[model samples]
Target: MGVSDTNYQIVYRGHHLEYFHPGGWVFFQRPKEAGGGFWLGRTYDFVFMIELPRPVSLREGILYLQQLKYESAS
Candidate 1:
């Protein structure tokens, strides 16, 4: 297994879900495929959390996360 995954238990990978930070942040590792993301397949650059300024509904929060992921990747 990868070093970053040594002590980490990943529930999913493809959907930008990897590990969780203590501060309620989730990380999504960029894939090694072409045009992956900001991390560009580098395991270390896999920070995928964005803190929203205001409180949002659970559905909105998920949308924000997805937006952040795409923004960061582009």
Candidate 2:
């Protein structure tokens, strides 16, 4: 199933934490934090689901998201 088959929502604004679900999987981006401008949250859902090995950086998260799409393609 290509990523197109997988239901999801995407957020890019750097505002307060936002929540949105476009399909079976929920997606969210953690708001920026007070820790020296680094986002204390995430660009992808990590709080309520997706047991990540460790918190991923913005770039890493984006890359992983891309991979998710490709994987589904295969």
Choose the strongest candidate by TM-score. Answer: 2
lDDT tens digits, residue span 1-74, model 1: 12263332222236544444443433233345643322211123434334443434444545655676789999
Runs of candidate 2 with Cα error greater than 4 angstroms are: 1-18, 22-47
Cα lDDT of candidate 2 equals 0.44
lDDT per residue (tens digit) for residues 1-74 in model 2: 11245344434345433454422332334445622212222233344455355545555655666787799999
RMSD of each: 13.4, 7.2
Candidate 2 at 8: error in angstroms? 6.7
Span of ten consecutive residues with least summed lDDT in model 1: 35-44
> Where is model 1 more than 4 Å wrong at Cα?
1-50
lDDT of 1 at 5: 32
Q: Report lDDT (Cα) of residue 7, candidate 1.
A: 32
Question: Candidate 1's C-alpha lDDT?
Answer: 0.40
